[model samples]
Target: MFEHIDFNNLLATYGYLAVFIGCLLEGETILILGGVAAHQQALHLPLVIFWASLGGMLGDQALFWIGRYFGARLLPRLHRQQAAIERVTGLIHRHPLTSIFSVRFLYGMRLVGPMVIGASRLSPLRFSLMNLLGALVWAALFASAGYWAGQFLESLLGDLKPYRLPIAVGVVIVVGGIALARHLRAKAKEQHKA
Candidate 1:
């Protein structure tokens, strides 16, 4: 699996498309990592940002409609994850804007937040505007972080170009896996603690 996906080459060759797909899958980490790749000259910055933001908008837009259309019906089906569902519902009830945008920063929330909003009675137009703004800001932040990280790393190591791909993949896999594990572990702990 790892051998097949060449991060640097892929992002460099297919920045926007890759970003779009990443966003569609709610792969914010990959999107942000692509930004870092952009800094490496392996990818184009503007293209990365454009695709990522577009993907985010489309993904969230779809979710909003899902909520608007099937929210009530789906609520019962979400019995196992009722707490999370309710949290999102509360988010929609209380701070809809924060629910729409800030969820992008959260791994699990990214997927559920939009769906919850879609499930709620929030206005589609309002959701669209918030989703777009959030997606753009999120894309800019991650892309910039990725690009600058590349530059900073290059300067720090004095010659990261040679080991760039290996280093990048290593970092991506390690950090991403760690974060995921931590999230899962925390969730598990919460369940047990609760």
Candidate 2:
């Protein structure tokens, strides 16, 4: 059923939107795909980065707003992430700017860290500014990784025309599997904690 899909055309049309939405959650995988699309000339690298930055910044902002406005009511529900919350709290206390700037890069803390920061006493304007910078860096870094990866593959395999489908499928499956595994693990951990 999927054989007739023109990846290049599809990506060219919706790749930026995908990158934007994908950056909202587990974006690394999708952003990488965008980068690959850019390498394929199916998408533009700068636009890919732009959309990623916008989406990432807005997503974190929304989370931050939630934490700021509803943290008192919401935090208790996240007992499973207590350790992560505490770590983020400690970072905020010690280095507010650094914490806000680097939270997205920290392993396993990407989603929760912004919310934690939101719950803190840090200024919203400050958080917004820093979050923007962080998003830009994160987007550029990951998207570039994808772009270079395509280049590396091309150098090794000559032409990528024959391998696009397998590569795309493999990336999606691997990313999905990883996301599902993490979700299940976290769910089990929450249950165990309860």
Best by TM-score: 2
Q: What TM-score number comes out for model 1?
A: 0.84
User: RMSD, each candidate, Å?
Assistant: 3.0, 2.7
Q: Candidate 2, which segments miss by more than 4 Å at Cα?
A: 173-194
Question: What digit string (tens of lDDT, one per residue) describes model 2 on residues 1-194?
Answer: 56787777777788898999999875888888888778877889999999999999999999899889888788778876887788899999999999999998876688888888998958999999999999999999999988997898889987876677787787789878987888788778767877
Best by lDDT: 2
Write the residue-wise lDDT of candidate 1 on 63-161 in tens digits: 778767887887678665566677777776788888887777765677667878877777788888888999999998888877887787878776655
TM-score of 2: 0.88
